[model samples]
Target: MRATILMYHMIDTPVTPAEVRFCRTRENFRKDMQLIREAGYHVISLKTLLTAIKNNTHIPDNAIVITFDDGLACNYENALPILQEFGYSASFFVVTSKISGFNDFSWDYGFSCRRMLSTSEIIAMAQAGMDIGSHTVNHVILGKAKTQIAIHEIRDSKAMLEDALGHEIPHFAYPFGSWNPTVRDVVMTAGYTGACSTMPWPNRPDTDPYLLRRSEIKGQDAPWQFRLKLHFATNTMPPITEMRQLTRKFLEKTGVISLRKF
Candidate 1:
């Protein structure tokens, strides 16, 4: 009944050095989807997972949920096509204030400013059966903000997104994966059925819906590394795994092994 929730950001080439960690090439995204299919995993929506958590019912052990944060234009321009080709459903968490605008706030974190998804694109995705969730009004870091600011961000973002899509926005992702217990309570009071966090682990029936753990899929991961994360629901390697990777790197660096072999 354990399920892994995979987190992704932009689906395009890195716009800056800071973006390299967050961006995944479209080709790689396709390959990742293909790998998921070949691995016999079932892709489920966030809503389905939340329902299962609520009902305390059993879900497939191989169930995985795909989610994209920030609602970048590439999500519609690139990722959507691949996801549709695979007939997979994903949840998109968007910043309410950035629809149809540039992500100027990214500059504050030293990330390259990129275009956010347009309202039209978001509505189209929702129409196409993608779950549209709320990230926040301004991507405020709820855990660090004042109580009133957190309340405003949590409640207002949901209201704004619902108004846009003409439907309930029942899920949310903590901005910057930042949330304390108070922030969690705010989200609960704001009417979110579930919330996503940056913690890397699989969710179980006993796991808190508001503190749902997600394993981030980074652009730097190799195909094998991606498989490991998918199966293990974590990127943190154990001691033996770390030693093996180090040994492999040393051998490759010393010319005892060829990159082609890997």
Candidate 2:
């Protein structure tokens, strides 16, 4: 059966990094989660995805694998509890280098802040039944880097997580949802079973495992918007990818400086 994985960033709260504008607020996030619950989609972990795809096991008609990028502290503080309450499982692909404390955040936005999850917080989440994977030691756009650098980013990250968690970190995510065929080969060599990309659409049974597509969830999308995004791309390039590329080009042409500030 086909499945969808939703990628999200910050949940609602205040004190966002001056540059991080996509942080979803708690009120809206709560509403979205509620909507998910109402929709009857089973919020599952990546393990379920792997198992179903590999074994062709029977799964619910609508299954979703939820993921949180950057390991935000708010994911532990705000999102985890709600997830537990909802009996929803999610995966957190952590940046091993960012485990120093709760104060260090990603450089994705124009500014930086302490929003990512700490080692202790991550451990707690894992113990509480969340799946952990590698997002990299730091978030790097592997598609743009040299092969050697890409290998280090992809391979070293899984190693780092294994050392920390004392277990295999079998899954991955592209730092920016960016990948090329070379990048995919490196990830496979790094020993990851799968790597989720920011492709943004429903994945079919014939989907590529190494370059698994995911639905990019933003704080701004309502249930209707999510539905449309999940269904827009079927046989060709995903709508989310097309939308992102088009939006990027439009922004570049118009000199909006919205997504480029970071």
Best by lDDT: 1
> By TM-score, who's the top model here?
1
Q: Candidate 1 residues 108-185, lDDT tens each? A: 767887899999999999999999999989998888999999998899989998988889999999978999999999
**Model 2 regions more than 4 Å off:** 14-21, 101-108, 230-262
Q: After superposition, how far is residue 140 of candidate 2 from its true place, in Å?
A: 1.0
lDDT against true structure, model 2: 0.74
Candidate 1 local lDDT, residue 131: 93
Q: lDDT of model 2 at residue 29?
A: 67
Residue lDDT tens for model 2, 29-55: 676678777777677678878777777
Number of clashing residue pairs, candidate 1:
0
Candidate 2 TM-score versus the reference: 0.81
In model 1, residue pairs whose N, Cα or C atoms come closer than 3 Å (at least 3 residues apart or on different chains), thus clashing, are: none
TM-score of model 1 (CA atoms): 0.91
